[model samples]
Target: MSNITVCSHPIIQQKISSLRSTSNTARDVRELVDSITRLMLHTVTADLELTPTAQEQTSPVAAYTGLEISTKLALIPILRSGLAMLNAASDLLHTAEIRHLGLFREETTLQPVEYYNKLPRTCSVDQCLVLDPMIATGGTAEAAIQILQHWGVKRIKFVAICVSRRGIDVLAAKYPDVEFFVGVIDEVLDRRGFVSPGIGDCGDRLNNTA
Candidate 1:
């Protein structure tokens, strides 16, 4: 398994830094997160395969062709805060299918339990990317990937705004074949399973708390 590649772009770092500031208002943070998510999507999807298609002009003298994605792609958001990132990914990948999975951490146990799940009728897509803002304990992400794999998603990508080292390590050991992309890899997970230095509870920040 490969390590989660933390985006090192200067612009991404600037936006992330803004998002992390305690002084940032909820609205500001929300916008920053969305922007960062869109930028991150670009980096993550850079390697996607595309097929060329020819275009005919009115003059019929000039040949023009554009590339279209070769493989089907799906985006599965793990719920609440994950839904926050979902919107950005959808805006960027307008043609990609969207799936939803609800997994919330049990406050006391820090274990994730699913409250809802809705997937596309088929998962034979060439690539399916799981979108979630945070991956701290790995429970939610692990469970999410299990569901996708069961649906026959052969190639999977995990995208998150931030991840705790322990969480990344756990996912690598458990799902070695899947690829992970993260904006930042935090130094540690706190006792409550929250990533230290992470932008507080993402769902809370997004006003999606239950």
Candidate 2:
């Protein structure tokens, strides 16, 4: 089962289209990426658990629900490009706790391993959102989810700007309960481990690298 949810908003699609073009300047590309991330976050955080709080107003009393509880959701960024999307997801789910995990693609086999890990100590988390800009071969994502599972996270969701079919398949096969939220699903990975038709290197695009 391919459990990926691709955002279909016109604004998101338009901004992503701009990101796809090679002619876009670094500034424009960065801004488009930020815009697309914000939109994607809106869709991803729609059903977030919230706790109701009442406040007195001069006219009438009203209540609003803030993100239910601290342990309700955890945001884990897979480092580098994932850090870009992590900021947007954090902006949307302000109350959601953040756990930083740094994973890198090995030069030889592209397998992911932990360079840094700071998962939360609490084990009552209801859901966790993993942020990675590109899921080319599923190596990093699989390892990240596996780590989360070890830490007692029951529900997991992955958010990425683009993903390859093979990557999605690999993840689903490893962890069927995890859901993926992507902006676009692209073609195969190139020989260099980059997604074809992908927005160059997402980290480089966001950071204006050469």
Residue 79 miss distance in model 2 (angstroms): 0.9
- Cα lDDT, model 1, residue 1: 47
What lDDT score goes with residue 165 in model 2?
A: 77
Candidate 2 lDDT (Cα, 0 to 1): 0.80
Worst 10-residue stretch by lDDT in candidate 1?
54-63
Give the 10-residue window scoring lowest on summed lDDT in candidate 2: 62-71
Cα RMSD, each candidate: 2.2, 2.7
Every candidate's lDDT: 0.83, 0.80
Q: Runs in model 1 with CA error above 4 Å?
A: 1-3, 54-61, 208-210
Best of the candidates, TM-score: 1
lDDT score, candidate 1, position 128: 88
* Tens digits of per-residue lDDT for model 2, 1-210: 666788988888888788889887777766776678889887777776555445432435654443243347788888777777766777777877888898998868888878999875756668989888788888898889889989998899998887887887777777778988889888788887888788787777767784
Residue 195 alpha-carbon offset, candidate 2, angstroms: 1.0
| Per-residue accuracy of model 1 over 103-190 as CA lDDT, tens digit each | 9999999888999988766765788889888889999999988888889989899998888988998898888888898888889798
